[model samples]
Target: MAATFNGRLFLKNTAYLTSTGFKVILAYSRTTNFFYAYYVLRTLTAMICEGSINCLALAYVADNVLERQRTSAFGILSGIATAAFVCGTLAARFLSTALTFQVAALVSMLAAVYMRIFLEESLPNGENLTQPILKSGQDDHCQDGDLSRKAPVLKKIPSIQDIIGLLKSRVTFSQAAVVAFFNSLAEGGMQASIMYYLKARFHFSKNHYADLMLLLGIAGMASQLVFMPLLAPHVAEEKLLAIGLLGGIADALLYSVAWSNWVPYATTIFAVFIVCVPPCLRSIASKQVGPTEQGKAQGCISGIISFANIISPLIFSPLTALFLSEDAPFHFPGFSILCIGFVTMIAFFQSVLMRGPPPVSSHKISCNSLVA
Candidate 1:
């Protein structure tokens, strides 16, 4: 809804402030039931907000950035998020849990306040940020002018048909969506399977997971921040996407057959290349969309990713558990991880074949009008 009608900057900042405030309140809540209640409220609020700060920020990038630099900009944004993971891990290591949560909330609140005060709306000049964008379609069922005028109204929610229409409207958009799905599937499956596989094989603990995460996070940050921008224009995002998928395949393969405890940690360097997948995929998606519908297009891509994330655990978790147990099955402990690699392999091939001419947005019909 914020994507279609409201000011994205304002909505994102407000959502951040509200969510962080809820986290702060939850941190201080006295009752056990209230803790769960706080979480439930937060989830509901998230649903209402339609998307996260990350997706909204991506939409903002699509709005403000030029085509040639979009991929690099997305890489920078991704790098910052990776840096957050590194920072969060370090903070949790040093700070007490209560202090950490409070500090995180304070930082979030200040950032939100700062954005709300200073950030300009990602709308064209003269477009009111606080006002909703609406179009009055003629009512077919009403013949009277007054009734026709009264019945015409646009909904402020995303529609399934519009998303389908957008996908159908451009082959590139659809290809980008598929790339997002498979890449997310591979990443989510790896994340779900690797920890348990390591725990079973090498007897790793929470600290080991933290160390692994730190390595992955730092690698991702450096590659996206330092290397990606330099490579984006020359290589192009499509080639970058293929490169990331290839890296994912290699990472998964290594994890599946890891010989020693150090193998997993040492191989975390693969994240430096793997992190290119998302930014490149999103950069490709943004180019398939027009300036006005950047958020809507990004929303569709995000929905695909969210759906893949939901399905990934369902597919990989059972596979991991079954292979790890002493059940009558194959002896390969990293079978699930190998399957994850196959997922990336599929994405890699698809990305290699992912070719489309640039979308002609100037004459493109608006998909939102069909269902908005």
Candidate 2:
């Protein structure tokens, strides 16, 4: 809600600035200067807010949904977000920029209110009440007087140590983080490069970008809703992740070497599989940790993705700028995107190395029979 309000304010201020002749200078021709400082600051702030919400939401889903069904649950979440993107873009095309932002702010506020009213807390009050008592007892036993100072600190915000410990304790969790990090790294490059590429290469206007995004969102929603659920029960999450990464590699390559305008549209076929990557990785990561650690596990994954978002632009933006420039570096203009594909390839190999979770149903069945 805060992010939406802030975003609305930013858009309003930008409009005001433009109207008053203090126009924001954007370098359309260059990739290096694609992000203005104002935009970057706004993006970082928004990311911080949204990232927290996303982590919490994923954690809630993980806590509520069974292990076997988590991929589909995450996929549904992704699908809803994708659907909103499509709807929001289509709606924005008709509304004025100011009106669009206002609508966004209002929608965010409404969603918050709805959640507050309708969404039940996944963690029971008893569990939360017991945790502090356990912690306090442990702290009290550790030292005689240290409990006073340590108790206050512990009662405050939760520490990130548990989240960090996942990387050291679980091989699957670490592998999932690697896949998520590189996947996000490659995706971040695409986010930064693709729009500029489309505009420069195809003379794509606002409408064109909207149309493309709408199509991609539709494809993504279909993949998340239909394909992921259908495959999750039969195929291992690791295999699904590997398949998604492979598709991402192909998608990136297709975009990089796109000669004609139609090529970008054609790559939506690959989006069917590519969109399954994150949910698959999330399932794998969630499976590696205990039920109690879902929040911490998802938080760690979110942090890795956030870190990738920060780093990808630093690495890919310069490469994109250099290759797109008239300097005699290389003939291929799509070199940066091809590099993105290679990055995705690296993630694919990492996914390949991940050991699948052992079959749990057989053990469950055996235990049930023995109990009977």
**Among these predicted structures, which one has the highest TM-score?**
1
> Over 4 Å off in model 1, which ranges?
29-31, 124-156, 359-372
Best by lDDT: 1
* Residue lDDT tens for model 2, 1-372: 121112222332333233222112221221345446546645655644546566666666776777788888888888888888889988988987556655665665556556656776564222211111112123233333222222221223335553455586667778889989999999999998888777777888877877888899999989898888888888888888888898999998888889999998899888888888988887887676544455556767888998999899999888887777788287887888999999999999999999966554321112222123
lDDT (C-alpha) at residue 179 in model 2: 89
Per-residue lDDT of 231 in model 2: 86
For candidate 1, what is the TM-score? Answer: 0.87
Error of 2 at 230 (Å): 1.7
Q: Residue by residue across 1-372, what tens digits does model 1's lDDT show?
A: 346556789878877876776677656653788677778877877775645677789988777777788899999999998998899899999998778877877888788878888888886321211111223343333332212222222345657776777788677778888888988998888777888889999999999999888998999999999999999989868888988889999999999999999999888888888999989988887777555566777778888888898899999999999999999287999999999999988888889888744433333223344235
* Model 1 score (lDDT): 0.77
